[model samples]
Target chain A: MTTSNLHAEIARAIQAAPLLSPIANQLLQVTARADHEMKEVIDLVKCDSLLTARLLRVVNSSAMGLVHQISSVDHAVSYLGERLVVGIAIAECTNEFLGKPLDGYEGESGQLWRHELFTAIASRAVARHARAPLPADLAFTAGLLHDIGKAILSEFLRGTSRELVADIVRGDTADYLTGEQERVGLDHAEVGFELARHWKLPEALAQVIRHHHHPETAEAELRPLIYAVHLGDILAMMGGQGTGSDSMKYHLRQEYAEHFTMSKDDLALLLLECSEEFRKVEASLASLKET
Target chain B: MSQMVLGIGDLGASNHPDAEIKTYALGSCIAVVLLDPQTRTVGMVHIALPESKINLVKAKEKPGYFADTGLPLLLQEMARHGCQPKGKGLIIKLAGGAAIMDHNDTFNIGKRNLLAIKKILWSYGLGPRSEDVGGTFSRTVSVSVRTGEVILSSPGRPNWKI
Candidate 1:
């Protein structure tokens, strides 16, 4: 197939992809703001009875281990915070898309969700070291949705892992993104950007989905958050939570040093912290998977 | 037969003859498999990083997360199960530590993890009997306690005994 035809197919796939839940969409909009209030998140959950229930359940779930049972939506959202609330809403609405098997990458069902969850948690941790003010929760949301394109592109990429790996080994392609472009004419990042646009996601998130692998290319103001998600993605893969064969196959832009003030020791600690949080979050959100 | 699976930054040992110990999706992480033929005991540690000094508190809570802390704790676990780390009957096998494609990457964790594990093992006068490490692919590894055979499998690759 020609490059234009492949891109056309990708556009169609993006159009057919599932849309985010109303609650999730609003949550993204609210959280994307630099000065969004916690009350806004609380009010959004209050509007959705099911989200309220899930939020309460997750906050009181054994994974959280609170001594007292809390039944109030406001209390629940406050305790779990906006990131976990957003994660719960997104996971609940997109389980099929997020948890599906990635045959293209030889990945099992739910692998991508786990990898994204880790990246979300890791991105939040990475945000702490940002040289400038960056909302940690926005970073979490970007990390969570960073690889959504992989779901749509996985089918198109079927049976290409070997050729891609071989190409990478022989230096015929620079990295997995290049290998992907060489084989399919569009990489997952670009595909994800299309999905983000289809979902009418926040501009910052669309930028991240498009340029996570090469954060330096993103607008200068967004680099810090983009770099957070970038390192968070790498940290997730390094922690062995990658989706599949393409694990750690991308180039790590050392320019992240300019965006964040992380040292080698800090990076190592971030991995440990992220893994620890990922365990608890995965357990807490297991109930969402069932729904 | 029972199967024990280790997640990243985890370790375990078993003495049951029919037991199998395994870990999945080992990208840059290293899995150290220890088997004792005399006692038919097997152990494995999925190490994610090379050192413990990065976070002493985490190392104390989950020593299996790093090569320095995890290897020692894994050996001690083996000793408790009657599998001596330095015993002649012990067979040590290493797998995983696959690097990313970038040669200039500062976080060359896979190579650093391999070097760290080897250095730690040398301190105990022990080394792997065999190793299947380094690549751009993730690996899933398993060891049989009864036969002391370690097998490795990865996506798009055939399963092989290491």
Candidate 2:
């Protein structure tokens, strides 16, 4: 689609996608305190049984590589500390809120999860070098749930026309995004931004989802956060885990680093740090398997 | 299938059964299961996130992300061809789940994926003889049970043996 058409469609999708309804009460009360404290957040998380169990399972899982047994939420929180602890809690919370698969991509089932994790990693790395106010955990949650709109409209789009989606899979953006815009009148980014606003996530994060691919227009206040998260996604896509069935069409823009005011050295450091961090996190995760 | 590069949502196994089943660029997404000793059964699913205990409907929609829903289904599918979950030892080797999100911190998916698999294994109490998982660079993984090799290749050259 033309740039103007693309912009309009994305704007429309933002209108239709699933997000917290202002009328609805908070989905769940959360008391996640910053400054890396754990007990307070644990108390809030413990109130939710499913979250509690999942958190415990996550704590005990061999994937983490931590042999320590964390019996209580408080203990689990303390053991992992705030950054990692909050990240895990956010992962648990995210699964509940994020809807089904998106219509455009062939996620099959778990594609969103994969995308989220990678996004989180990418954001943390980008923000570290950029030194933006955005917290790694906040970006992680934002990145994890960015493409949520895709799931909400997957069935509708599937029924709308399989051929259009086939074209998107084939990287015919003009047709795919345009078709999506015509049908839903908005793209996934707009929809996701709305969801973020409704969720009361950091405004910057919401904007990141809204303008991640094209942060030039994001609100000035939210620009840096959006840029960091955007670059994170781009990096993950570059890493090539899964940019959906239509990845070939979207190439990474080198200007993102400059937009975020990151130096080449900074970008190199981000990648270098990410690589080292990937190993550490991977090792920690490996140990967390269910025993 | 094509040996070139099987991007996400695309599964490709080497046409030759004797040949290896290789897929690169795996991070948090699963490399699925690749079994060769018996019949040519290699499943690779690129699950983006983790399970949604709170959202069962979403879970139903995304069995690949959640260990609770995805593993049993995958195992059952493999079982259709006499590869029962409990009976035979399928030398399963897993990789990916490198938390690119947090460098100072680590997300639970890499851990969760591992845990989910372990729980499935616990039901049957099965574990891979060994594995090479969790790194920053996207992994170039190859699993050939027939040859008993699960090689992982990162972006830079000099991939390691499993």
Candidate 3:
């Protein structure tokens, strides 16, 4: 199929894809703003009783290890922070996409979610090292949704893992992203960008979903934030939390040095920290899966 | 037969003949597998980084997460299980330590991890008898306790004994 034809098929797929729940959409919009207050987030949660209850349940979940039950939504949201709140809301709305198996990559069900969760945590950590002020939570959100295109593109890529790997090995393609483009006429990043547009996600997040593999190409102002997610994505794969065959198949753009100042030791420490956080957060969010 | 799966920074040993020890999704991390055929004792540690000094606290809490700390702890666990490396009967095999495609060698963690493991083993007068390390792919490694058979697998690849 021609590249244009493939994009048209993906366009149709994005159109049929589920829209974010009202609460999730609102939460994302509110959190994307730099000056948004915790009150705004709490107010949004309070309006959706179901989300409020889920948030409270997660806060009091044994994974949280609370001494006493805190019944107030305000207390729960405060305790869990915006990241987990947004994570729960997004997971609630997009379980089908996040939880499904990536057959094209030979990934198991829930693997993609695990990878994204790790990336989200890692990206948040990387944001702290930005040369300029960057919203760590925004990076978290971007990381969480970075690979969403894979969920929709998996079926179209089914049974192509070997062919893709072979193409990469023989130098027919530079990397997995290129191999994906060569085989399917469109890469997951492009497809994900389309879905981001379909969901009307914040522009920063849409840019991240598209250029996370090559942050150098993103807009100069957004490059730092995109670099955070880019490094986070690599950190996830490096820590053994990849989706599947495409695990570490992408290139690590070295230009990240210009955006974030991290020495080798710093990178190692960040990986350690991300690994520790991923375990705790994954355990806490596993409750969301049960509900 | 029962199987025990090791996550990153985890280690375990078993003496049961009908046991299998495995670790999955080894990207740049390395799995150090130890087998003692006579006692049917097998052990594995999934090491995530080359050094422990980067995070001493985590090293103390999860020794299996770094090459320096985890390899020594795995050796200690083997000793506790009555499997000594002093004799030739002990077998060491390594897998994983894969690098992402990169020209600048930024985050050449896979190469660093492989070197670290080899250096640590050399200090202990031990080395891997077989290895399947350093690639751009993730690996799932397993070992059969009874047969001391080490098997390696990855997506779109056949299982091969290393």
Candidate 4:
């Protein structure tokens, strides 16, 4: 197909896919505003029974390690706070889109979601360590959606292009994102940005999805946030969290490592916490499967 | 067959013939495998970095995170598992240690890891029987205790015996 035709086809595929649930989109908007009222969040969450049930289930679940049962959305918000609760709500809402395999990336079923979850958890840890301007939950959200483009781009890379990408990435000096652009006319980061725009997500979130692979190229104000996601991505890869065939093919930004002074003990502790969070997320997911 | 997975900064050994010990998603990290043909024993260590001087506490706590410390710990565990540490029955295979990010050789942790492993092994007068190291691919490595077979696989690439 011609380059324009391929681009059009990719755009159509992105539109056809289930981008994000209405509740998740609303949560995204509410979470963007620092002064968002708790009552507004409670009211919005109450409108979706699935979101409410999942939130209550999560807070009461051993993942939260809370002995008291959160019987209502109000109690959940009060106990877990608004940002974390919204992060989980987003996880629940977007599970369908995030929880699948990307053949182009060579991940098994649900591997992408696992990777995203790890990145989100690790991103929060990096943000706190770096003292980034963005809130922990926002960093988590940005990390979770950093690879949404791979999901969209995978469809367009079904045939010979997949091999082309794999070969180029495996070469001595080729970067994965550049290889993607060369073969498919656009990279996953850029495609992911377009998807975020299509879903009407906040501008900061969209910019994050675009520049995560190349944080230095991002706006100065968003550099710390982008670096958090970038470092989190590397940490996830190092830990082998939900990685696929293309696990280590991406660029590693050592500049981020230089900016932060992380001891081995600190890294070990952060990863331990991330592993705990991963197990909790897995437990909740298992329960979701049961129901 | 049962499979035992070794995470980063982890080392494990087993004598069960039905067991297959594996480590997955190895980028710059290295998986060092030691197999004993006579006892059907297998040991593997997934080491992340080169040396332990940078983090003494972590190296003390989890020696498997570095080549200098992890390799010795793996060997000790192998000997404890009733395997001949220096006999002909011992077969060593190494996989992973790839420079996934090719921007420059400055932060080539994979190359540094390989060099460390070589230096440490040379001190013991031992070396790997087979290796699939370097390049820019992430690898999953497995060793079959029953047959002492070491296999390596990566995304979009063929799985082959090392």
* TM-score versus the correct structure, for each prediction: 0.94, 0.53, 0.96, 0.84
Which residue window of length 10 is worst by lDDT in model 1 chain A?
A: A262-271
Order of all candidates by lDDT, from best down to worst? 3, 1, 4, 2
DockQ of 2: 0.05
The TM-score of the first chain in every model comes to 0.98, 0.69, 0.97, 0.89
Candidate 2 structure quality by residue, lDDT tens digits, A1-291: 465765565555545544543211121223212353445566556666655665666667665656777788787766655445445545444444442454355444555655666666778767765644555565655666666656554544555444554454455544333656666666667666666665666555566677776677776666666777766775565445343443322333444555456643344345434543554554454333335
Q: Output the number of the lDDT-best candidate.
A: 3
Score candidate 4 by DockQ. Answer: 0.36
Q: Which segments of candidate 4 are over 4 A away from where they belong?
A: A37-43, A63-68, A72-75, A78-84, A160-162, A165-173, A254-276, B7-11, B48-77, B85-89, B99-126
| Candidate 2 C-alpha error for residue B7, in Å | 12
Stretches off by above 4 angstroms in model 1 are B103-106
Query: Per-prediction DockQ, in order?
Result: 0.57, 0.05, 0.71, 0.36
As for candidate 1, its clashing pairs are none
Query: Model 3 residue A249 lDDT?
Result: 88
Candidate 3: stretches off by over 4 Å: A1-5, B85-88, B103-106
**Candidate 4 lDDT, tens digit per residue, A74-124?**
998777666566667767767777777777767777888788878988998
Q: Encode model 1's per-residue lDDT on B106-155: one tens digit a residue.
A: 45677888999999998988898999998777889998888888988876
TM-score of 4: 0.84
DockQ for model 1 equals 0.57
lDDT of 4 at B39: 74
